[model samples]
Target chain A: MRRWLAAHWRAFSATLARFAGAPLTSLLNVTVIGTALALPLGFYLVLSNLQGLARDYSPQPQVSIFLNIDAQEADVREITQRLKSQPGIAGFRFVPRDQALKSLQSRTGLGDVIAGLGQNPLPDAFVVDAGRKATALESLRAEFARWPKVAEVHVDSDWARRLDSLLALGRYAVLMLASALALALVAITFNTIRLQILTQRDEIEVAKLIGATDGYIQRPFLYLGSLIGCTGGAVAWLMVWGALWVFNGQLRPLAELYGIPLTLAHLNGSDSMATLLFAGGLGWFGAWLSVRRHLHHYNPS
Target chain B: MTQIVLSGVHKRYPGGHEALANISLAINAGELVFVTGHSGAGKSTLLKLIAAIERPSTGSVIVNGQNIGTLRARGIPFLRRHLGLVFQDHKLLFDRSVIDNVLLPLDINGFDRREGTRRARAALDKVGLLHKEKAQPITLSGGEQQRLCIARAIVHRPAILLADEPTGNLDADYATEIGVLFRDFNQVGVTVVLATHDMQLAARLNPRLIEVRAGRLAA
Candidate 1:
């Protein structure tokens, strides 16, 4: 295994030298792959940061389940307990009508007017911090609608769900974009490798005639494809970072508007590894498929 | 013992062009054999079959101790190490220097750079082109280029040498020089098979001659 690794390293060194020797061409190749990879990565960031904001600001999007005006205090407490056991309410707290009216008056600065005319017209309520995920909260909303003691469930999380769906739509958009670009990616690699094979066809014929096995001849191209894909992955990482950096300087107002901080979605260790494997796998498979099909045509022997 | 054997070997293209049909031969070790025929007479195909480049559809080809007809695609490189192949063009790796080109087989054979370089120089010296080890293919004369190719092929001291029109593009003198090199290598127990259409040139070498006529062995 050590020896094979060493051999592959030497082969790769040779490949790198060749790749470096043609810098302009390889740079073009890398850039093409990078662009293909960056689109999905960029969209992923938009969704990731928004998801982060949604996660941190859970209280901002909670549903306020107001009880019937005559509902018992004990009944409200029972609902709070039941909500705790429910999956969609991440957590909740009860507020009696008087406290609710008091807090509302303070926030709206209508306390004096409310103090003169009102006997706590506001109903007893439960404030629910909905689940981090939008889909999970839907069931909870449905349950509230069916309850007899519930006067209304005012879902403040509506905007969040809307925003998340927009983000989810954005994710689907990225998926569709990635799927389309993935086809382009494969074609890009396939064409690049095909041209390379055509240019190297003479060498291939000699290798074949000299008793070099098809695998032996095919090995170097496999390495080349993997390297191309790996390089593209690195380029993609840089592109994602570069884009975030450029936009980072301009996002302070956006963050303020959203009332939360967002760390721009960057590729994590897992994502980076996945992208590397993904891009490289794309390139390697492309080259392998290309060579397997064309090596026979150049077999002069 | 027959060092190379083929019987009833045939290659039919999918479109039904019979590239080689019923090729049969036995070549002894230590013999310099010339496969002479017109173009498309199956000379290249026969050589290819022996090297395991193309699979023979109808019969067996045995080289050294193994039946090449039974060899897998992955087995060809290891099999190639036993044979040195030369083409009409020197087919040097343009990206590498002459010494580096010669060292390629050694590299593949798992030899270190220093030892490979030493063997490369010695092989170049044997071909009378040692001083030009640092030169690239594009810089060398036609004769010198082919000689360098010969050096690269023999650097590993392969058991057999396969030359496909080695002198096809050369002048008479360069052609004869390459023939002499093959003769010398054969004398040293390297089994030599020279594939060419130059019958007059084949006579000068006085080697065992196999005529390939329309893909059939006509020796």
Candidate 2:
């Protein structure tokens, strides 16, 4: 076990020195990979924020039943009782004709115009809260619309449903974009690793001639690929966070216009770790494939 | 006490080119032997066969009690670990400093870093290139570069040393120096096999000479 650790340490340090040997080339490779990775990750962050804001700000669907203007007060009482008994109905509040007109006058500042009319124009109503998703409440609104003595039924917040569908489509597009960028990252790593193997061909041949095993010859290149990948992942993380910082400056005023306290989330700890690990794994795999293809062509003889 | 024993060894490459044919020879431990031949006369092939870099087509090559012809692919590195093999060209990594080139064999063996550095320096000193340890191989003279290759080859202190034209590209003075270095190592009980086409240099060294003509050993 001790020997294994020592061997790995040696290989690691040696590979690190080789990378440090050519800093500009390594930096160029890493920058390209980082930029490729950042596009998908940035889109994901935007989609997540959109989903979050939609959840917090979009009002719930409310089913409102309006009684006939000539219906007796008893009909309003009966409808309220019926809504209370409904299984899915969470709660209901009754608004009489006079009370509705009074509140509308106060809210809209049309009290004098209402007094000049000399009669209440609003009908008695019950606002029912279904306390369920839009789909379930939609059916409740439909049923109430068909009830006797109901002059009209309005389902508030229908715009929430439209926004939900639009957001779902956006999420799907982001997922597709993420997949395409991931494939691009793999191909980039593959090409870089292939070039590295070619440049080190003479070193590998000499090592093999002097009794170095295939594993020994391969270790440094594998480490080179992984270092590039992990550093690229770190660069992507920096890019996303920096973008959010700059974008949040513009987002605050827009969020204020809608009266929602919005703050976009950065990647959580586990998410960041996963990103780094995933990038490093791709790099290791690319290096493994490149080395396997070329090592067969080299023999000590 | 025989270090290498080849019996009826033959090597036939694909496309029907036979490089060695029904050759049998033996060299005892601590013996300095020379394989002298014309180009394509199988001198290099015989050394490669003993190094286990190429397997014989039809016979046994026993080196230090292991049958080279029957060794598995995974066992080749281990066989080479006990033998020091040198090439004629492309022997040094010009990108690395001389000491680093010598440290390669020790590095592959996973030797302790401090101890490996010490051994690498000692090997460089043995080749009388200690003052040039930090120089890149391209900056060294041809003889210095070949000596660096020898340093890298024997850094791990292998029991057998095989050189394929170690002095082929050097002047006579440098060639004599490298030949003397081989003689010095052989005096200390290391089996040395030097292959070359330079008959004059071979006569000067006056080692146990074996001649090859065509694909067979000549008497």
Candidate 3:
């Protein structure tokens, strides 16, 4: 076991020496992998931050049921009681026609135009707080619109629902981009290891002739590939962090304009670790494939 | 007491060129045997067969009682670990120092670094290349490079030593020196099988000679 460990250490150290030997080529390969990985990671960060913004700014989705202008007080009372008994409705507030007119005047600054018309154009409404998904909110709106005294129902959380759909789309796009880039990363490692094997073909032949097992001969290349992948992953992580830092700096003024503390979160611990392990695993697989293919063709005799 | 045996071994390359044909031979443990032939006479092929570097086409090559013709790919390395091989090309790693070249076999066998280094020095000392241990192989003369290959082959102290034209590129003096080294190794109880086209070197060593002509053993 100790000898095995020592062999592995030697292989690892030899890989490190190769990297040190060709600093420029190794750096270029790692940079390419890092840039490829960063694209998907950057998209994910933006999507996640947008989702967080939506959650923080709009805690509960709301649907507004506007009654007809001719709605009687009894109809309003019935609608209020119905809302109170609704399962998904968290809460509701009744706005009389006069209160609706007053709020419209205060918010829109169209009170002079409204008063010149000599009538309150606002209708009594019930603003309902619903803690449900976009589909559920739409269903509730449709249900409320079918009521006798309801003129129209509007989901005030429509923007949030659109944002959610957009986020879902972004997540899918990130996944696709991640998958494609992961394959590219593997291909890069495969080609890199192939070239290394070719350059060291003489050494491999000699080693095999001198009783080096196939495992012993392949160990150094495997180490080289995994180290490249792991270093590239770290570079990708740093690039993402740097991008987020820049994005957060730009978002500061925009966030202050809306008066919400908006900062894009960095990748969590598990996510960072997953990125590194996944990259390393891809590198190892690529090296394995290249080595298996090339080494099989070697006839030391 | 037979350390190497070939029973009607034949080797044919992909181009249908038969290198060895229906040849059978045996070399006992601690015996020094020379395989002498002209170019293309299958001398190197015989050494490769004994070293398990090449599988016989239709016969068995038994080295240390193991049938090399039937040895699995994974088992070949273990068989080769008990054998030292010297190639005509002087396949020394040019990227490493002389000492590192010698240390490779021991490293492959998983010997401890300290002990491997000690044995590597001893092997270099045997080849009279210890003074150039830290020098790169590319810097060595033709004779020195061949000596370095010998040192690398013997560092692990393998039971059997197979040399395919060990002095093929050396001058008369260097050739004689290499022949003496093989004789000294054989005296210490290591089976030494050497292949060469140099009849003078073979005669000077005065060991058992097996001649090959047209891929068949010469009667």
True contacts kept of each: 0.48, 0.54, 0.81
Instruction: For model 1, state the Cα shift of residue B68 in Å.
Output: 4.8
TM-scores of chain B, in order = 0.96, 0.97, 0.98
Regions of model 1 farther than 4 Å from truth: A60-94, A115-120, A126-150, A253-265, B6-25, B34-49, B52-61, B67-76, B164-176, B195-219
Worst 10 residues of 1 chain A by lDDT: A206-215
lDDT of 2 by residue, B1-219 (tens): 999999999999889999999999999999999999988999999999999889999999999899988888777787888888777884788778999988888988879889999999999999999999999899998888889889888889999999999989988899899998998888998999999887777778789999988889998
Model 1, position B6, has a per-residue lDDT of: 85
- Model 2 residue A122 CA deviation (Å) reads 4.5
Model 2 residue B49 lDDT? Answer: 94
**lDDT (Cα, tens digit) per residue for candidate 2, span A56-162:** 77655678889998889778777877787787777878888888998999999999999999878889988887775777877898889877789998887787777
Candidate with better lDDT, 2 vs 3: 3
Task: Evaluate residue A48 in candidate 1 and report its C-alpha lDDT on the 0 to 100 scale.
Answer: 86
- The global C-alpha lDDT for each of the candidates, from Candidate 1 onward, is 0.82, 0.85, 0.90
- TM-score per candidate: 0.83, 0.88, 0.93
Q: What is the lDDT of residue A192 in candidate 2?
A: 80
Question: How do the residues B1-219 of candidate 3 rate in per-residue lDDT, one tens digit apiece?
Answer: 988889989999889999999999989999999999899899988888888888899888999989997889899889989998888889888888889889889889998899999999999999999999999999999988888888888888889999999999889999999999989999999999999999999889899999999899999
Measured over all alpha carbons after superposition, the RMSD of each candidate to the real structure, in angstroms, is: 4.2, 3.2, 2.2
Residue A37 lDDT in candidate 1 = 89
> What's the chain B TM-score of candidate 2?
0.97
